[model samples]
Target chain A: MTTTIEPRSGTAFKLGKGQFLEVVDPQGQQVSDLLAFNAHDTAEVISNGRTFDYADTIYLTTGHVLYSNRSNRLLEIVRDDVGTHDFLLTPCSQDTFRLLYDELEPHQGCFGNLAGVLAPFGITEDEIPCAFNCFMNVPVDGKTGKFSVEAPLSKAGDTIVFKAMMDVIIGLTACSAPKSNNGSFKPIDYIIHDHLDDVA
Target chain B: MTTTIEPRSGTAFKLGKGQFLEVVDPQGQQVSDLLAFNAHDTAEVISNGRTFDYADTIYLTTGHVLYSNRSNRLLEIVRDDVGTHDFLLTPCSQDTFRLLYDELEPHQGCFGNLAGVLAPFGITEDEIPCAFNCFMNVPVDGKTGKFSVEAPLSKAGDTIVFKAMMDVIIGLTACSAPKSNNGSFKPIDYIIHDHLDDVA
Candidate 1:
């Protein structure tokens, strides 16, 4: 098993040998990220090639490759127990924050979590656009043609692993979706491993 | 830009040719569930053929294709604006409902909106396994390896369209995920079209 801790701020590492990161929550739930980014300029780690349109994309556990826009392999889906994740959807915003909470103080209504994390890595807030909704469930309604949150597919310890195939800049944000049924401000645990190493 | 209203059920329909149904909320936000099903088995969709090792896989969006175990294209992602949906994740559940909210009656603790919609369609609740977290932001921490909710990537009026290359039975559930931050709910609206006169 390989365990690597990035304590230095603004430190970006290359996923050399395909590493698996397990994201766990406070309740031991494997909370995943809506979107993950690698700083590979050569397009080594961009997942979701032209298979699905960006605007309508949804993310799930298995059968996908994480590559750069240039189609460079960043991570390969190894274990997808959570089942699915959505890419087209955006995170709740200040407006949604207000809609979800009538008591939210003004100016405190912003989806800054991504920005907060990105800041340390020198990635601008504007650079952090709409990310993938990791573990949240949004099912579709055929009769009315709509979408609604359904029951969660993941358990407290269920996880998904990715084999990192390249050296890329990875950015992840702990979602603070105030509009979810699991809207509580809970935290998730993230672990990074070296290439060809057993994940934590 | 076609519109069809079913007066009897008070449901409306608007479909783009070769496009999947795009649902929206009153706020005009694209209601997240861009659906496609196998023309053969109403209960089966595609699997994540490339990412993980799972047989009966159903893709929400992005990485995986909804191909049948028989290697048939049950549902190919023609378009996805909801971004990458997570398949590893499942819908919210009763425990989560209770965990996210406080003071709500336990009677209200009942979850299973997906089943509510699918059950009527002959799809059992048990079939609703790990689904993708579409358009919902849940980020992972690279350092601490933690997970948290972020704002959604979608805005008001945004929607995704899909084309059913063949006749098929589709299931959807407009999520009524209550805001965990404020206990508020976001309702959704949608439209569907089967063919020229079969629009719903």
Candidate 2:
């Protein structure tokens, strides 16, 4: 099945073991937040710390495995068009917005989107874990270890695919950074397929 | 109300605004993991990063306010006998135990206790946030910027009192580090009281 996640919005879908979920940047310069939870047990959700530790790299690309807090493998990256994905930053939230910009008006962000989309599955706001920012340009300065958000390196139609290591629920949000986007914020598309099917 | 959390176990309770919860190390040398979530909305749980950022210190003590991920005030430390506490480390889990040691038998840990205690309140394991380790001695070396878990500095009868900023649910687990503890792990006590009462 295929779906288009609108800008500043998110969707949740179940990906069975051995299935593939392809996240595509339908338009270049856009970023998406990807979060996953074990379908059978939500406590075992995607953990950035474990993923980074297991992968031994800050940046993720094809052949990397997304690990849960339990150190269990959740997904294995099978394909990647853009190699610069971020696992360091938390999803943008209202609190972060106010902290960074002093803005009061509620802006659409990943935290709210993840909360809204996962509510039906009994997932609440507190359950939202740190997400993997696919196609997001957050570079860490070597000298100061400071991270800066930048425009994505992906081109239009760039995609990354992950094969599920277990039955899992995947959440995706088209990042909503009105001020940070280089020019425009755009939507992204996702496709889930059976591993045995050779769609490529 | 008063409660005792057995060693290697945990319990959950609700604290309303204008109320205080006192966590006591009945027999010193015991550590406990304290985790809180918004009673009305779970998403606004206590966040270690925000609390550290707001306090501008690595150690927590009397008068420090615990902040949630949303930057909302969750708890205020009104009284403390042991000023040392940990906000850097996550609750120990089976995954972490196996990673660090080759131990095959599943030993009791904070993560399991939190999950078990909060299950009745509909909090799944995924919802368990990074905890505030009370009475735990985790010291960081300034020069190398490395943290080492040491024996707790708190003595028997040491206590910390937190005033609820809002209606919140708290989960506490007595540390169950069989081999890591200097000697042995022990149970702790807790008491909830209304701020208007002077029961002391």
Candidate 3:
């Protein structure tokens, strides 16, 4: 199944074991926050901290495994068009914008988008975990120990794919941080393909 | 309702808005990991990063608010018998034990207890975010930039209370890190009181 998450919006879909989900950055300079939860158990959701510890890298690319809080592998990155993805930062929220930019306007953020999209699954805002920011440019300065977000390096149609290790629920948000990029947001597409039959 | 979670075990319960949950270290010297999820929306669950940033303190005490990923307030610490709490570390998992101790035997850890306790609620390991390590003595050294876990300072019957800002599901794990404390673990009790009726 395929889905398109519009700018400032979010969507959720299920990927059975042996299935692969490919997320496409339809337009360059857009960041997508991807979160996943064990379909059989909501408590076993993706954990950025564990993933980083397991991979021993701040940046994620193909071959990296997204580990859950229990240190279990949930998804494995099987393909990537853009090699850089951020697993260190939490999703952008209203408070982040308010505290950093002092902009009081109700701007769209990944927090709200994830909450809305997962609500149908009986998931609430408090259940939202840190997400993997794909196609976003966040560079760390080794000398000063500082990091800054820049425009994405991916071009149109750039893609990243992950194979589900178990039945899982995936949530994606087309980040609406206008200032993070070129003062505009764009949509992203995702496709989930089942390969269980082939494995059988 | 009241529940006593045995040492190295866990329990999950829900508290409505205006209700308060009190956790008591009946035997003292015990560390408990407290995790909260928005009962209405799990995606906005408590976030240690946001809470620390909001309170501007590494330690949690009375009057501090536990903020969610969406930056929404989830719970407020209305009372604290032991003022020190660690919000900087993730719960200990089997992987952590293996990596640190190199002991291959099955060891009890906060991650497993949480997953088991919240299983009935469909919560899995991935949903367990960085926890508020209640009564756990993890002190950071300013000179060496190092921290070590020590035995808790709280005495028997020491208690901490949190008033729910929203409907919330709380998970508590009696940490099973034997070496972190004395050579054994102790149980903890929790009581939930509905204050909404009193308010009305």
Candidate 4:
């Protein structure tokens, strides 16, 4: 199954174990925030700290598994055309705009978008953790420890695929922040394939 | 006023704006997880992402301000006897023990400890975000992006102090994990100074 998420908006859905999820940047310079939770337990949401601790690499790509707050495997990256992604940032929100872009009105950004869609799954605002940003660029300066959102390197049709390790609930957004999407908004594409063969 | 948090335990209390909070590692090699939320609004909690972005350093010390989710200043580090502390990892929990140490019984760790104390202020389990770990050592390999919780660098009587930027609710813990405390558990001390003159 394939679906399109409007720019600056998001949606939530479920995937059975062994299913494949492909998130695509149909247009260049777009960013998407992705979150996951164990279908059996909302408390077992995706954990950036645990995933980073276990993976040991901030730059995750194909074969990397997203770990849960409880340290269980939830999903594995089966393919990644654009490997650069951010695991450090909390999803942007009304506060983000008020802090950075004073000229524009504060939008809820990805955080609110996720909360809006994930509510039906019994997931609340607090259950949302830092997201796995696809096609977003945030480079950190080691000496200064400062990072800035940069334009994504993705081009039209670039995609990243994840294989579910367990039944899971997912919240995803076509990011709303101006800087995150190179100062413009664009829609995102996703597809669920029941088998690896279905992905290709 | 001064208080002591028992080994592997925690407590929470209100802090007035401009007051000083000094967290002491009474014994050497122990870690403390510290969290702050606006006293007026529990939803406006301390944020590591904003702090990291605005402060521009993961290795925070004297003179850095901790920011809130809404981009408000929450606390400022007034004194730091020990310089190195971790800003990346989440509070350790039951699953952390289950995944890392198979022989030891699973303990709720700092996450649970914080949740226990903060609940009274209307902050539920999900409201707890990543904490500001004092005297905890987690060094990330620049090339590999992997980080590990090493024993702290603090010595007996070592302390870190923060000046409240606002009236805030604070949660603190003397970490429970054995590895975090160099194979031992110990108490933590905190003093609330009504004024800078009270600190000395």
Candidate 5:
């Protein structure tokens, strides 16, 4: 069944091994933060450091595998239309707004959304690691080693698919941070497909 | 007073505002992992994301400021001998050795050491965030965003100094990973000096 996650909100659900998760960008420039954890053991969650160590590139795309904290293969990027992504940032939080923005009303960012949804699965805010940001643009300067977040390069109808390598719990968000979504927010659409063996 | 952190060991201490912390590479080619937290509130710790966002550079050096999770100024780099450092990596742990190395004995890495010392200060293993890796070298590809951990460039007696911008608890280590120190581990030396105001 297809599911729509409203803007600035998030959800966590179980995904079986070999299932394919399709994340679609219904509107251009919207960013989504994705995370995966072993369903049997929440401690073994997605690790950007491990993934980057093996992938040999931060600009991950189709064919790259995501690794867990314990170095187990978690998911594989089976398909991707928007190749630009970010792996260096922690999910933005309430403190992010207090620190970076001057608005009178502060919005709890993606970290808050993820934390609220993942709590049911026994995960805490402090346990949230660096997220696999789908369709986010962050470019780093070679000489200065500085980086900045820019508008995503994804267009409307862009989609990315991840094939689960193990039974996992996934935390996903329609990113709430304004800068991450080019100063706007929009819902994200996704659907899951089970492998033939699981169906049988 | 001068304190020497034995090879692959770590320590934690209290640092008052305006105090100067001088971390020295007693021998060349060693790396140190440093972390800071607000003394009054452990929840407000050093944040690489915030520091990088405001400093506009990941190659932190003299004149750069390290920011806390709450966006408070924590430390200012007052002096530097080796300019290259890493802020993108979590402290290496036993899992790191198990996954990346083939050693018969997997030493609990810097993460273990930091957890041991910082626990007394009310900080837990999960609370430990990305560290300021002193003297470590990690160069990222501008195009690929992939980075590799390289041997440190610090020479014997090389020193880097930071002036605390707030009263903080500090966790520091003489790194255990062979790759960070060019296959050899050595001691790290440090000294703390109080400001004139503190003395008065």
Candidate 6:
């Protein structure tokens, strides 16, 4: 199947003050561990008392809103059409690199991209708690009881935009888990746009 | 600079029966959000009487051997390389997959990998708590107080193999964070030796 995606962009704004964030995966493929956290405390940010579950969530092709735990508006996805996305799997870390790959490879240098983005805000790797894998697919089997990567449920070039709810620090990783079906070697691009004053 | 690596081939017994797991970033990198949980209980696991601290912890690396609250051996490094790893992460779950990735991805399907390994023996994910990233280099800068990923001090292909003291089941994920400087697109290979045959 062909993945159809549209380019979208947005900028950081006061999350609850009418800003939002959107992500569009055109191929409808799953992207695991796409998450946002409160940089100061490093706690998993929540909405409606629920942690962001990427697998169970469905980002509309357009016109969906992102909220925070406090019921504050973070961002609104102004555009979409990328197709279905996955959030079942998570981004790999150093420990994973060592456990799954040959022992000869130096895994100590491995780090989580989510932890990378929080560095500037006094959040270190230790402060990084459990995270959200935004786009990726993970299917569970009832009979054999196994998890496997499925095909892309999303298309290419789809977009979702989020307006910042607070002056929160956001960390994003263009995941590269080729070992699983959620991704390929192809690089994905993103666009971040500043919300207009009127929109705020 | 060249990465030094040690390979273990041919006879399995040739590999060291015991190895140390150390965590460090000699270049002075700060890592945060470090966590540890019981692989069996899914409850928060603590070290040195507390959840890991950035400044206080240098190496969650193997050789250090983890102690249970009851003074039992919970986990040991069976394979390793590089001087650093992630201690604060856990294997992704179906619930997490739905919230973090997308809802479409089957939650039950993705859990099989971890469950299949543990379930036959009656182990469950809730029993699989968060883990400490041993030998992972997560540091905090005393002067600037910044945290980031540093090249692991360990040689390439160097590993600390864990010997299962009991019939305990373990779940692992080889993280794929190219930016972390650990492994590549390929999956990490593991050798599940060191079975306490006497205990069984």
Winner by TM-score: 4
Q: What is the TM-score of chain B alone in each candidate?
A: 0.61, 0.94, 0.92, 0.96, 0.96, 0.48
Question: What stretches of model 6 exceed 4 Å from their correct place?
Answer: A1-17, A24-33, A39-41, A44-49, A52-88, A101-111, A142-145, A181-183, A194-200, B1-200
Instruction: Give fnat, all candidates.
Output: 0.00, 0.07, 0.14, 0.31, 0.46, 0.04
| Residue pairs with backbone atoms closer than 3 Å in model 2 (clashes) | A43-B126, A125-B43, A126-B43
The residue-by-residue lDDT of candidate 1 on A64-89, one tens digit each, is: 66534332455666766676555434
- lDDT (0-100) at residue B5 of candidate 4? 95
Per-candidate Cα lDDT values, in order, are 0.42, 0.78, 0.77, 0.85, 0.86, 0.37
lDDT of 5 at B24: 92
Count clashing residue pairs per candidate. Answer: 128, 3, 26, 0, 0, 166
A68-154, model 4: which lDDT tens digit per residue? 866789999999998888787878887777766774668988989999999999987755777888888877654445567889989
Deviation (Å) of A110 in candidate 2: 1.9
Report the candidate with higher TM-score, 1 versus 3: 3
What is the per-residue lDDT of model 1 for residues B1-200, given as tens digits with 9 covering 90 to 100? 43321111112122233545544433332123323344445445322321221222222453334533223444444445555344423344554444443436522111255555455456553344333334544443322222344455566555444455455554444444443112334544555645424432
Q: Which ten residues in a row have the lowest lDDT in candidate 5 chain A?
A: A191-200
Worst 10 residues of 6 chain A by lDDT: A5-14
Residue A2 error, candidate 1, Å: 11
Give the 10-residue window scoring lowest on summed lDDT in candidate 3 chain B. B138-147
TM-score per prediction, in order, is: 0.42, 0.66, 0.62, 0.88, 0.87, 0.40
| Candidate 5 iRMSD in angstroms | 2.9
TM-score of chain A of each: 0.70, 0.94, 0.93, 0.97, 0.95, 0.59
lDDT of 6 by residue, A1-200 (tens): 12222111111111233444454453445343344555344343423112221212222223444444322334444554443343222345555445444455533321355555555555555433333334444343322223345554555654445555555555554444444334353333343445533221
Calculate DockQ per candidate and list them: 0.02, 0.10, 0.12, 0.39, 0.43, 0.04
* Candidate 1 lDDT: 0.42
